[model samples]
Target: MDLELRHMRYVLVLAEELHFTRAAARLGLAQSALSAQLGRLERHLEVQLFERSPRSVTLTPAGEELVARAGRLLADADDIERQLRTLSRQPTAPRGLRIVAETIHPEVVNALAQRHPGMAVTLRHDTAEDGMAALAANTADVCHGWDLPSVPLRMRSGIAQATLVDEPMWAVLPEDHPLAGEEQISLAQLRTAAWVSPGPGTRRARHLLSVCQAAGFTPDIRYVVDDQEMVRTLLANGCCVDLAPPRHLPEQGCRAVRLVEDVRARLFYAWRRDSVPGWLAREILEESRDAFVAGLVRRGPLYARLVEQEPARFGPLLDIDPAGWPAARIPVPALVSTA
Candidate 1:
């Protein structure tokens, strides 16, 4: 039997609550009915996903994995439903654009709205990986994020991407940290420092790994996290160091220093081929470039120096070649973008 979306949802709720009674109540089903449905689901998959006792409930290892997969599946399903609903509306009605981004400046969103009075834009924030997944699944029309020379995002097949801004990565150190006063810091200089980073195997994590390996030492990752704020907090406390482009400098209690290495971060937007309207897409690209560049140049100090040093490099952008996608790019002046 094919597993249904509803069955996955049932499993998700049960996994979260870890109790049949609570999950059933939340789903508006009786305890017995919920149990019967779970039994059918288990038989269909031929796997016992949960271990239950009179006293408590817990997931089997397989259950744990399914819970994670279910979340992505459900999100994609919801995205598809939303897109269908929007498409089913009057063809001449003002169309809505759903954007999933790790970080999109407010000025860009405001500018897009101002430029296209008829377009409805929705911004949803998520991790870069999840945002790309949404774009791939057709839940979102576009995703905005940064692609670094060290950590290029893995684009899903068939997606077309355009670069908007290029900026340089910086070492984020405690305000009083020894290297904090330096205008630039070398990767080798940071080799011995404790680091906080994204989880292993993620594109960003892998990039950091490669960077460290090239620097002749491994990063002593003291914390594995997905939250940028947590990384900043750890760095500010003098516990560890993290990296960001100059545009995404730590908000407080840390200093940003340019890296001597040529690692660059390119701000980019990816969408399904032929999904976005030509006018709106071009407007988005233009506004993204303007807003990003304007912010960096206005932010002063590091921003001014970077633009002054590499103006041509930040001008007009290019798309990732579909054949090699993120791994291959047509050579141009290298650029890095801030958040």
Candidate 2:
């Protein structure tokens, strides 16, 4: 039995919507027809992808794995179609670069747009995990991600990477919290407090767990949220304690303290070692540096003060000198294209 691309797409949409009626409505098909299609796809794969109950539908482990792979496949198909269309219109269309980053700074995209008027550039905001997957799947030409060095990223083979930012994580707490008055609070000190977490299985959550474990106790994570602003709000309202990079400022009700532990957060720029052209890699690195620096500058006086107070903690930004706008060019390795 063979499964068509439409079958995979159907599974993806169903997995997203989780409700037969909603998925069917989105697909413009009757619920019964959608159910029949799902049944056919499952039979073809010989695996039950979802758990169905009167109240809800949820993906099984197999379904979760398939959804991830299917997303990459669909992105790759779209990229190929776009390239073919571009070539059909203009045989010598300028080469394209697709970047997948957790948060692509608009300044970076705009800078690239200005510098390389003829080249095609696309930036996608996806999770770090998805961004790396897209690079491995050839759907993205570059990926930007962050992780603790101790929790080393599990990179796919043939990927080349360069470190863009190396900075420290700061503790966020209500101004009146006992440890908030301290200049540097150790992880062990916060063990008893309810914490804001990024949720289980995510890199941020796993890193927090590892750090806490190293400090001799697992964190008491009371809330799981993905929004940084929500985390700030929680800490400010005396709801929970959390962590963020130094770039975060303590607002009126909360304080951003230094973590005594030596854990460092690193940001990386990566691309497929075999396929990326040298010129493209260099250009991307330069633009990324500009964007990173510009973002810090935009953070205003508090950020600049933090950087000044702890230049070593800020790493590469010391070289950035956003105010002075340093003239020296920081060199990145030229890619050796194997394609």
Candidate 2 lDDT over 111-135, as tens digits, reads 7777767768898887778888898
TM-score of each: 0.61, 0.64
Worst 10 residues of 1 by lDDT: 320-329
lDDT: worst 10-residue window of model 2: 330-339
Residue runs of model 2 more than 4 Å from their true location after superposition: 1-94, 249-252, 300-315, 321-339
lDDT of each: 0.75, 0.77
lDDT of 1 by residue, 156-222 (tens): 7767777766766778788888898998889899888888889888777887888878878898998
Q: Which candidate ranks first by lDDT, i.e. highest?
A: 2
Clashes of each: 5, 0
RMSD, each candidate, Å? 24.1, 25.3
